[model samples]
Target chain A: MLEPGQIADLTEQLDTDDAVAIIEDLEEHEQKAVLAEMEPEERAAVESALTYEEETAGRIMQRDMVAVPEHMNIGDLIDYLRKNDDLPTEFWEIYVVDPAHRPVGTCQLSWILRAARDIAVSDVMKREQTLIPVDMDQEEVALRFQKYNLISAAVVNEDGRLIGMITVDDILHIVEDEASEDVLLLSGAGEGDINEPIRDSYKARVRWLVANLATALVASFVISIFGGAIEQMVALAILMPIVASIGGNAGTQTMAVSVRALAMNELTRSNTRRIIGREFRIALLNGGTIAVLVGIGTALVFSNPMLGGVIAVAMLINIVIAGFAGIFVPVMLDRMDQDPALASSVFVTMITDTMGFLAFLSLAVGSGLVSF
Target chain B: MLEPGQIADLTEQLDTDDAVAIIEDLEEHEQKAVLAEMEPEERAAVESALTYEEETAGRIMQRDMVAVPEHMNIGDLIDYLRKNDDLPTEFWEIYVVDPAHRPVGTCQLSWILRAARDIAVSDVMKREQTLIPVDMDQEEVALRFQKYNLISAAVVNEDGRLIGMITVDDILHIVEDEASEDVLLLSGAGEGDINEPIRDSYKARVRWLVANLATALVASFVISIFGGAIEQMVALAILMPIVASIGGNAGTQTMAVSVRALAMNELTRSNTRRIIGREFRIALLNGGTIAVLVGIGTALVFSNPMLGGVIAVAMLINIVIAGFAGIFVPVMLDRMDQDPALASSVFVTMITDTMGFLAFLSLAVGSGLVSF
Candidate 1:
């Protein structure tokens, strides 16, 4: 590891935000030592940034923004900017604040350049600005930027006083990480990344496999209820997995779609019923198609039309039920304020696996193809 | 069902890019009709945007950017900007170009404001830039914006001349969409969205289920090969699915990690072996933990120590094989220029399902726990 002076020397060459990011990742004592080695102004900036928790707007916001009083003219604003050497190297917009430092509006660079020098900043500024709360999660910040097509937004503290601003450049990587997080979490792959430690990977994945064990046990218990039927008609044993496999796949498909929709905020209360209804219609089509294909194949292979009919009806029933469970599980989890992606898949799989077994075995007995 | 004139009016009230997006979503004839009703200049702009394929840099790039000759001074640039009435309402940077209109550097709005009037454009501009090709895919553009931490980048044609510019604000949505696309595709859920047409959803999901049907048959065939032993002992049928279930879950967890890594360009040829080794160790830990739990449970439930031992060995072997298949399938698919997310799951599931059944049932017979 580099010494404190060496680290401080390296960080001093970077932007204050970038410098803070590096020091924040260090151990507490090491960070303190590095901060002590820094210049007072830069040290104070880094320390202020560290006051906020990771992945929050306060942590990513730049303190180097320019905020002018709403009464200032474009000429004064331009003069202030040209005279200040401490300002950030790149900024697309400036906030117009009242006497209390509360942001009243935002003025774009082009608007400033186009307006007459004598025009008040308030006259050129747009009042409909998106303000990010200082402690907002970075993912929420990314969403706001995307939704409003923002170039830069002011970050306000609890009292609604403008503190700093976050630029779109700072948000690009956060969007990618958050979206990828949903995919990894949905698959029961906790925070999946190539650079993740092996022990961490084992811990994350084994916990999921162990959770799946309970679901597997539920499926086994369902199968054991019909163990006598399997003994009497061994062919049932050979073909039973096919129903569960297909049902699980179908459930996963719907669950993936629903989870993605939920993440993007596209599936909301107003459209919940409509989306569910749409999924059901899709389920009917998919179940019908698979039932026909499997039914014909089973009848020809086993030379037993009755058994084929039993499996066909079961396959369709399981698939449609799987679809309902898929949508319901994620939406329910989301409403409960749980991350739908994190836990939805395990529940959806459990439902499909249990239903897949119960539906097929019960149908086999009901149709007189086997006995309990 | 709005008329062409009404549609044109609605689109006219929006930004040019927004207008083009609305027009692009319409059927070709409807789009043409709407375009015909628009003012000639706006219609021409929309038509030019339509020449590029959907989801390309050309479609997303703004043609309204300002480019200036490198020798121009800051004072002249400001005068020209103030004189031009047709400039975009908002722009973060202006490209400094050569006589042939190829970008030599990029001048930020802040740089111009801070520089003295006599400072040449090239003196203040930063030469390092990320220039996007007009035909580059939108996802790739998003990646470049993210990698470079760019606020905006010039879009160049095949001739390496600046055509338009893509801003990070435009890229924010693409990052979310592309990342979400990876998750949806990996689950065999094609473009999964709640608002997607019912017919399209049905078509996408049913095709995946049918593909899964083929994989189900392979599992069923493996079970069929063990039919004699299952007939001799009903316990094999009751426990066989547990092996496949746990193995499949483990495989999916690994596959998700690998696919995300491959997508992010983190797991390249330079680090493939290291990641594979990392996954292998994780698999061992997972397999060992699961084996002990299942082995003891089976032994206590069935009162057969040898059966427990056979299952324990089989489970470990199957889980390890699953880990290999999970990484190899996606890596191999990615190397073939096919989307690893699209087909890796199907192939990995097929392998784990077959191996899970084969290893467990084969061990049962080899250990003389059941007769063929």
Candidate 2:
């Protein structure tokens, strides 16, 4: 989108990999033109990074890190750091590297500051450290960082030599992005970026709507079978949506909770039975509360006690079913190595809507509340 | 509920405030009994923290931090840290304080380790360090930390003297909590925790269902008005729910996007018009696609071209309205200082359901498509 000179000027202000990303977005000929204007060293680093797959640790790590010889004394380490102006300006820990360049240990700044002047780096440094594999998925890397509460971790190549470092600042963005991704995907709302291109947004969203149209047909087929009961009593038509909509809302509530629990790893096989029992009990409580209110209200509005009783039973049955379907569907999806939140709402709604219609209409017909 | 001895044993492993929180959850008499058993120093610190409201920075910050006088040289600071066995075991930076004990600057360990022993601490310390107010809400503190990419920040009292510190580890919990809160609140799904007590879960979820029921009544009233049309043609009853449910799903998709954009600060007044226009265009495309698919399928199933045509036009109209209500309602809520995600689903469904019914049934009645 820009002239070669403009790209060169802009890329100069960005990190090497970031600059390479912008250039790569342009035509192949323009990419070469932009790279040609960069310093040879900068060009090489960017080109090397461009070879890594996107969203991997290799693609995101900063190439600069403070790695010092393992044999240096505290005083000599300080002197070396002071004299090396090319070293990174900001770092939390100094990596202690062996002769072959693999990280042997790490010395946090706190340890260095607290060590005696004559103490050897080997003695002061902590021998244990979490190392990030160069080709690891960014999400897995983030999970490791979170598990260890890491401020920064060294990234090593397949051969185990230190290549770069990944900091908490970058992981912060990844965590936020991943968390929001699940929430958006639940609603079939693609990435949900307002600034995304119209074409990209349509491409992401239209297919989901099409999928929804398919699921909604399931509910419609159920409704079509209940046409006789609905035609016999116009009141059934008035009340059908209320039952289905309420059931859908209840299902969404339980689904939201179950999805979050699964994501947090709080609900596992060890606790699944207990959690299901808990939801079942909660559903009964919720079901009982809603049934009484709707039953009493319907009776007053329609002046038919049997009609009210039929609806109350239908409401109870649908709500309990909603609770079960909400947790069961997501758990089943998760067991199959699928993301529990993805299209969960669509499936949950399908079950609730179908069950809501089937229960209410079947009860009405059987009880002769609305004779067909 | 535990014996005083068990409480004392348990408290030993927890941070002072966390121990106090557990004690405070007990009855007043038991709280006093537990606090009395704590060491005097621990009790004093816990009592001071208890004075701050829950979920404030003061309640969360660690009391231990590395604070040094600004006049010290790098060698002197290093010696002090080495000599002080009572100082915190983990620290990222040393706060350089003035005579009044107010933080004047911060010296990161990396900078200190890289500096000459003869250099004054102030010479190497960063003066523009982030300082958090003690009473700031944890959420606001989290936002500040995220915006600045801070690993740790000093917490200052009202007098601007350093009191405690908050680390990125704690902020991780806050960020995750806030993100999940929005997702759960949007669904009106209480704190959907698998471990939440049945009573607590029931209390949280039922109120939302009750609110939804009230909204569902509006749709019911609308359907009640179209009773005559539905009785004359059973097809109207079968088809009505399809229109409303699809429209509701469409509204949810748009609402989810707008709410997330608002949470991320991606959609603001400056970009509101552009974003709204983008959603509007996407809606037309989505509406057109859905209308065609549903129209073709319905016409073939019912063998009534006019009936399909009526439903198609209704689908188009309702979907466009869903797009508007989804973004419009959330935006207005945000403008009025309400959380855009809270209760947004309820209001959006109400609008979509009403419009879907109004457009389809009104058309059916006027067109005499169901006048058998």
Q: Highest TM-score among the candidates is held by which one?
A: 1
In candidate 1, position A185 carries an lDDT of 93
Q: Tens-digit lDDT track for model 2 on A1-372?
A: 578877887876666545755766788888788888877877787778778887788877778788989889988887788788877657888899999999999888888777776999999888889999989877777777777878889999999999988877677767777778777888888888888898888888888888878887888788788787887788988988888999999999989888888877777988889888888888898888898999899999999888888888899999999999889988999999788988788899999999998899889999987665
Q: After superposition, how far is residue A298 of candidate 1 from its true place, in Å?
A: 2.3
Query: DockQ of each model against the real complex?
Result: 0.81, 0.67
- Residue pairs with colliding backbones in model 2 are none
Question: TM per model?
Answer: 0.95, 0.89
Candidate 1 per-residue lDDT over residues B140-215, each given as its tens digit: 8887888888888999999999988888887888888888988889888898977778888888888888889899
Worst 10 residues of 2 chain A by lDDT: A12-21
Give each prediction's root-mean-square deviation over alpha carbons: 2.2, 3.4
DockQ of predicted candidate 1: 0.81
Tens-place lDDT digits, model 2, residues B206-281: 9999999999999989988888888888888888888898899889888988988887777889988988888899
Off by over 4 Å in 2: A1-54, A68-72, A97-104, A156-163, A370-372, B1-34, B69-71, B97-104, B157-160, B269-274, B335-338, B368-372
Worst 10 residues of 2 chain B by lDDT: B12-21
